[model samples]
Target: MKSKSNKSICKICGSDFARSGMTRHIKSCLGKHFKAKTKGKAKRLYYLHIYAFYNPDYFLHILISENARLEDLDNFLRDIWVECCGHMSSFMRPGQHQEIGMKNKINEIFEPGLTFSYMYDFGDTTELSIKNIEIFNGAIKSKKKIQLISRNSPPLVACDECNKNMAEIICAQCQWDGTGWLCKKCAKNHECGDEMFLPVVNSPRTGVCGYTGD
Candidate 1:
């Protein structure tokens, strides 16, 4: 399916930016000045590239301290994309039955090129494929356990009916048919009614129950 614009708004600065440029922009942006930094010695950090298993183009790049726990990453994912109601989550190596706990330090198990899976909400779960892309020693900028680097530009999706204007809503009932995307005007008269429609969001979790994105 065709997607929407890849642009994203910086929550801190309210600046508009393309996905590819966000990482560099965020690093030196004035917004960073307000966030608290780690006061002690520098430590090794891991940079991860996380993406939706089914929609690989929808992704995020992030940095975390080596000592940060799996739970830290889980909370980051929840805050940024998938949290709605309190939900259970888990991480495990693909094809393995053993689950990794939130308390486990990232460096204890993660390494370059390693791939893992994350599942949120046992029912109607959102699955993510995570890869340890790079590792390096660096100074952490904020007291927060996770740092955003960049993310995939939102996909540009055209209205399925008008096939001209951008899609602004998706019909929950018709989403699986791939004919659910609609422009705002089309959405009003849709057979599914306004209640069945959800806002088009920059997330793989879009259309899932109660997820509106951060």
Candidate 2:
């Protein structure tokens, strides 16, 4: 797991800075500014805020080009939080059962005040609720279709048995009975045994099937 520090390294300049300040710093960085000027084309971008539907606290803020396909967004989500076992996934408009496909353009389907749903893995689905927060017309530093703006730090879950050390595993079977979390030590001694415990990861899909997160 990555450190929860506010600091991040600037990819353009190889300089260290607080996460909140990096955006501003990058705009003025010599390397990035030069690249933007060289490209000479600014694209329309959309800012999206997405969170796990059932676990709202696990969230991400991202920027994607308006021309980018829905498939790009779907790929980004899978790479960052949910892909495991190559399960099928889909996007659906609110209150509708019809599934939206990858060929759709972002600008065609999303706008401010619009919300969408994403379901990964048909059987043990990990659902996400996405909202179009804002739209921007500007130059992007990265060529990637999706850029991560920010994300909620991985939450700390205490060991259910000791109530001290951070939880390292979750017993899927015990989750329903409300005593699933356990640290490394407690997990070995858990009544359900280690086989029932899944490694806790920084993802909403944690403890679901064979998912261990990327």
Candidate 3:
């Protein structure tokens, strides 16, 4: 998965950036190119950069208000990226065993350079890497507890069968070896049969459990 190239669109500018460069891109854009009405009352919000753990291509850029709780972030993630079957999920320090409570206030735990791990659906295990990148004001004039500022563009994979065309389906049984991407046409002729197939969705949870897409 690391070898795959990935990119995301910056909603503010409508320009695309490579995964490796998104952090720098957003940091600069948020201040120079885009401005938020952070006036009114004094407010601080945490800018979190989140992405799939080992599979970094799938990612999200969020601006969470200081008053927001961990639960707010968890719900936002589930709504957009990984909530399949309502399985339990948690956030923890990257190398730790303890889980952070959903009720914990963002202002209490968030700090620049802090990176954490998020696991969704323990059984299928779609893990994500979350990091508090920066603290900013106003939150783009949003009232919501958390805002999804940006997300990675849908990754395109070539069909393993014909070696051309974007893959739209995966053979779940064959995904373990990372060799089951299939285009619409090739998916019909997969030797594993149609029952083992799963649609290739945008989220990192694609092909896992009963996930189809959001």
Candidate 4:
């Protein structure tokens, strides 16, 4: 009798696959057949992750993916900010060039830093669709959400010890003083249990640290 624990090989390909990557691996060899079979398949849903920058009432976004089309992303952003116009553009690789002003081909791919501009039509809904594509946003994720930050914008936070306005993270160890900006080294020192990190009311005016009612 055959044991229930015995493994079986795929009928399509004489290879053993526990799970996961098997289907994806088979795609390359059977890609043509798979594409042909799915020619009339229902459309697959995709999400467009977009970042927009606004100033002087102008708006631009770095189109991150083609999974959704240029129009879809514009609609999403319009919902987020209703008073702006939208435009869309495609970027080519470092060594590539595109026509000065012309519609992109259906097979054209977008690259990082490729700019897209659109006029916000003051519409309540915006949507579009495109082929599957990928976007690389470089290695800095912390600054990802600061798309709207500008030189003239107000400071996000005021460091009580340093008395300086800071838009980003403040070192938990140092007092908010100019020197308290404590370079990254000093920042690490605090993380290591430096004395400055001890519980103390250093900034009474700012009320950064304190007891219940005093």
Candidate 5:
């Protein structure tokens, strides 16, 4: 199915919601679907929202453990969004030393209303803005350190050449020039040639350094 450009899918209820309504809708859906509470430790769950810094088209709402390491979030982001060539990544808050954030647990750095930035692939960097939405005193019943609560379904992109069909590939060299999107039909005639074409994936890293998909 074609995804909603400005909406996301709620994992709990399988419903689509606009960006502004998703947070509240997810909380309500979770309440109805998951009555079971954490059984073992008194853990805290950190609600987080991650989005493209420049183009808010791609985004995700996640619940991460307070005890989870910064590296865990980094790895999760890599697995789902930005890991193409195994490049170095780090989370940073303005004016803070990078080492401190890299070495700390997520809870150590997170606070109410805290906002931060993440960088993946130092060369052709895919930067993301991360905000701590809220903190829950109890944890969800999950073994994973990071749980994907909701995510923006892939935004619909039409071929730039024809503006009719969905884009199937992006020409990296042409993307910077602002006219590279192509469908399978138009890809046959792309001036940049097939060698420069990258598969159009549901990621901000599309058309970037060696990144086809997660």
Candidate 6:
């Protein structure tokens, strides 16, 4: 009986069968072509940021798709930094080359948005290959520190009367004590009082008359 399935026969091989049989046969017959079209020929375009120099020298590459092999990365890097051929290194996308296994080859076919990288340890020149590879962002980020400059600790002046202690008091009449070191009563009497006593200029007296200039 006719299976009446959609698969009729292998068009290329010319074998007769049902619709399902024909479909399966066709797939088997063109397995290589399908694999090539889907895996090898298929390409995806992507953008890659390359850090070439020991410093932060970034180069941008736009491609229709990534090549499966890392060798492609080596060639691309060499072209970018022609001056440094063998010095450059290569890494793949999605994972850092250094972190991944070394034996992995880069020339394999790649899917879209795939990424790769190359580096130079600043070594001798040689025709570059997919050797030791490492990948890192060109810039490293860290928190910033703020520094405060103190105001010279406001010049600790000694007390004029009690030279043993720090002084912030100033004798108004003489202006000798810029910091105003006199006691509360002395400051009031010297500056506010009309009975100004000889301008508090003379050496500080031990008694009230001397300190307050009474």
Top model number, lDDT: 3
Error of 4 at 115 (Å): 2.0
lDDT of 4 by residue, 1-214 (tens): 0101122233334554432333333333233332345443223222122222222212121222224444444344434433222333332233434322233321243432343333332232222112222332222113232121111112123333344433122333344343343333334544534444422121111112211112
Tens digits of per-residue lDDT for model 6, 1-214: 0001122333334555442243234345444332344433333322233332332211222221222234444454444343222343434445445533334443243333444444433353222222112221111112111111110112233454445554434554444334345443444545434443223221112111224222
lDDT of 2 by residue, 105-154 (tens): 99999988788999999899999999886676665566788777566566
TM-score of each: 0.82, 0.81, 0.92, 0.23, 0.89, 0.26
Which one is best on TM-score?
3
Q: Model 1: residues >4 Å from true position, as ranges?
A: 4-40
In model 5, the runs with Cα more than 4 Å from the true position are 1-6, 27-40, 95-99
lDDT over C-alpha atoms for residue 192 of model 3: 94
lDDT of candidate 5 over 1-214, digit per residue (tens): 1324756788867888888788788667655554354455657878888989977778888888898998889888998899988898888885554644665888888886877889888788999989897777556555788889887777788888888898888888887766788889988987779899999888888889888884
Using lDDT as the yardstick, the better of models 2 and 3 is: 3
Candidate 3, 80-176: lDDT as tens digits = 9887788999989768979999999999888999898999988889999999998877644556887677898888788877877888888998877
| Alpha-carbon lDDT, every model | 0.78, 0.77, 0.83, 0.29, 0.80, 0.32
Order of models, best TM-score first: 3, 5, 1, 2, 6, 4
Which pairs clash inside model 2? none
Decide which is better by lDDT, 3 or 4.
3
Candidate 4, which segments miss by more than 4 Å at Cα? 1-64, 83-109, 122-134, 137-214
Candidates 1 and 4 compared: the better one by lDDT is 1
